[model samples]
Target: MTQAKATSGFLDQVCWNSDGLVPAIAQDFNTGQVLMLAWMNRESLALTASEGYAVYWSRSRKSLWRKGESSGFQQRVHEMRLDCDGDTVLLLVEQQGGIACHTGRSSCFYQRFSDGGWQVNLPVIQDPEAIYK
Candidate 1:
């Protein structure tokens, strides 16, 4: 079958939220470390499937965000899966540049809950200022 046909079938199964958005999680393909969580609209998800990379809906900007378009931290997807309820997407990817979080951390989930508070347990892999600019 054509790629479009395959993608269409997959997209039909996703249970998008009221805003027509679904939560997408990016995880390390090898280590299974969750890198970040983003949202995807139909267009972004379709683009991701066709392009073989990560594309997310930028809620703040109200636009499609091609991952690594600026910071060069692209996510090359190895596999994509839907949750049991079909409301979430999981992308197993090879994160480029070793940074997944905009803050330059390897993963966005760097804060750990401990001692009745949240603690930063991971060092920044690179300076955000340097990465963005």
Candidate 2:
């Protein structure tokens, strides 16, 4: 089958929201740690599958976001899976530069609920200023 045909078939299995978006979760391939969560539209999902990387639809910017386009922390997807309900996507990826979070942490879920409030449990892997600039 053609690449476009295959992509369309796969996309057809997903149940996208009214905005044509599905929640995508990026996870560490080896460690099984969730790195980040983003949203993807059909175009972004097809691009990600074809490009073998993470591509997301930025609701805020109303555009396609190529992961690591500016930060140089691209996620090389090892595998992709859809949830049973077909509402979410899981990407097992090798996080480049050992960093996934924009805050310079290994993962975006760095905050832990403490006894009273949220607390930072993970240290920043690198300075965000250096990573972005």
Please report, in order, the local distance difference test score of every candidate based on alpha carbons.
Answer: 0.92, 0.92
For each of the candidates, the C-alpha root-mean-square deviation to the true structure, in angstroms, is 2.1, 2.5
- Candidate 1 lDDT by residue in tens digits, 80-131: 8999999999999999988999999999999999999999999998999999
Provide the global lDDT of candidate 1 against the true structure.
0.92
Pairs that collide in candidate 1 are none
Q: Compared to the true structure, candidate 2 yields what TM-score? A: 0.94
| TM-score against truth, every candidate | 0.95, 0.94
Off by over 4 Å in 1: 1-5
Ten contiguous residues minimizing lDDT sum, candidate 2: 1-10
